[model samples]
Target: MDERIKEFFSWSDLFDYMVTRQLSHIRGNWELTWDHAAQEYEAEEDSYAELINRLVIELSELDPPLKYHDNEDRLAEYCKANLNWNIHKIGARWVGSDYASILEQGGFRDVNAGDLCLAACGRVKAALDRNQLHFDDMEEFHRKMLADVVAIILYHRSDQCITKLS
Candidate 1:
């Protein structure tokens, strides 16, 4: 709807707005818990971990294609590793952590995984387009490019997405 929001929906924009928004919602919850626990020292110190764990689970439930064992592991590792730590640094690093590497590695040659991921990305792009989330030709193309990339990734992994192309 908004231009800034449109910019974020671009695949070439370097961040997935939907995912970012979801993460932000999680962060807001985490902050609320942190504040609550800070005021109540006797509060369970494990509350943050529990919240993160739940968020990770929730994120994994978004789309079957996006859901993976590695997704849970990566999110858990990030929550555990960065608890009570620097928010900015953790936020920046969490995105590029083993979660993606794991997805890339496992999705390779795995038709189910690749197809799922590509489909999930496609759904996201389509939703964005329907919501008027494009800034220009470049942005529109960017979403398509992401879809293409996912398809290529699927092809590279298992020749499923590009059976005819290859």
Candidate 2:
């Protein structure tokens, strides 16, 4: 963690920042390329994949650091107000997956759990509103969404790969 990483109250604030950043990226990119007329047949853009690309850029530059408030509940409320989608799902695929498969469907398959977690966080940015997401309990989409949320929460709470700028 950078000495400058702006400390937190609970895990909630950092998670909120990650969520907001991911969503902003998704919406900006989608608006640039969206074609409502051909939307049904077009390959759905992967917000997670987009987030990976963004992380790559941020990491290389060591630019913006994570920032959050001093309280958890207040931060959570801020997150809810700013969220593009009410909630996203998560599933096992987020923690583990084959590079070939992720590549086939579109994602940086050759990534670690941390990277995968970020990918999940990224999906939240482009997620459908909770009410709009209509997947059966056993549906694969539902499972993946669930995995994304879980991975994100785990990443936010766990201290791994945290580094400081030299």
Candidate 3:
């Protein structure tokens, strides 16, 4: 791993910003929606502990590495420093099979980080809409968000597959 890349991105911070923070917001919304039966929302932290650890470990091992950011301005600075100007074309490897299906199903392939975040939010909405508030469903929701975060970072910083570990 390049020292520069390591200095710029921290998987733990990104996980906290994207997954943990988002889950907190989602739980708040769930509580508001469920009202009297809010306890049914069951978004236990234990549900995502293993998944988050696995994602961070897997990401840390990627070749050429990727990045994560909690700040838009800082991320933009990193992108400007590292990526080609006016050419945001991402490498093919960033889109996994499931993510590909998601883009295709949505009838669009061109995506920005915001789009990916929205897609992840959609997963949560779907789970809640169906009243599938099980821990398994919440875990899946977090998994999708984490995958999208990986895709977003890899889109900017890597052309290698997520499975291409060093």
Candidate 4:
């Protein structure tokens, strides 16, 4: 990875930032009024716990590890509030054949994980430009960041490539 990219990933709060941004979007879409959306997320916290715990465990296992809250309850609550809740599923699906077409066109089949992350970032940007996926609440920078994280997760999960991790 580029030094700058490595620095970006090394930020202790990068995961928090990404999840917070995602939660904001999810909240906005879940309710018409901001206050109501906020309330809804809070109300749903308890119900989201079981799922969040599973996700946290999964996240801990990823290469290029992320920093998570040390307190289990606090971590789970943060995850629920930020809606990092769905990242595991997102990563899993991305690693599957779901984005194969995009990966193929980007010539990413035999690349290293870092290269795959870069390709995924570009494909995500292209998709946004084509309006294939709407992320009305997120900015271009954020979308790319999220794509990079997902691509990293995909790289860890998939065995389609022979590139060894450095």
lDDT, candidates in the order shown: 0.35, 0.30, 0.34, 0.33
Better of 2 and 3 by lDDT: 3
Per-residue CA lDDT of model 1 for 1-166, tens digit only, reads 2233323322333322322222333233222222233321112321222322232233234443333333324433444454432222254244443434433443443444434343444444444556644423334554543434333342343322111211
Backbone clashes for every candidate come to 1, 11, 0, 0
Best by lDDT: 1
lDDT of 2 by residue, 84-118 (tens): 31422243122133322232222222233333334
Total clashes, candidate 2? 11
lDDT of 3 by residue, 21-71 (tens): 434432222111111343211233323333333333333344321222222
On the 0 to 100 scale, the lDDT of residue 73 in model 1 is 41
Best by TM-score: 1
Candidate 1, 142: how far from true, in Å?
7.4
Q: Alpha carbon lDDT of residue 99, candidate 1?
A: 37
- Model 4, position 102, has a per-residue lDDT of 33
Give the C-alpha miss distance for residue 135 in model 3, angstroms: 27
lDDT of 1: 0.35
Candidate 3 Cα lDDT to native: 0.34
lDDT of 4 at 90: 48
The number of residue pairs in model 1 that clash at the backbone is: 1
Scored by lDDT, model 2 comes in at 0.30
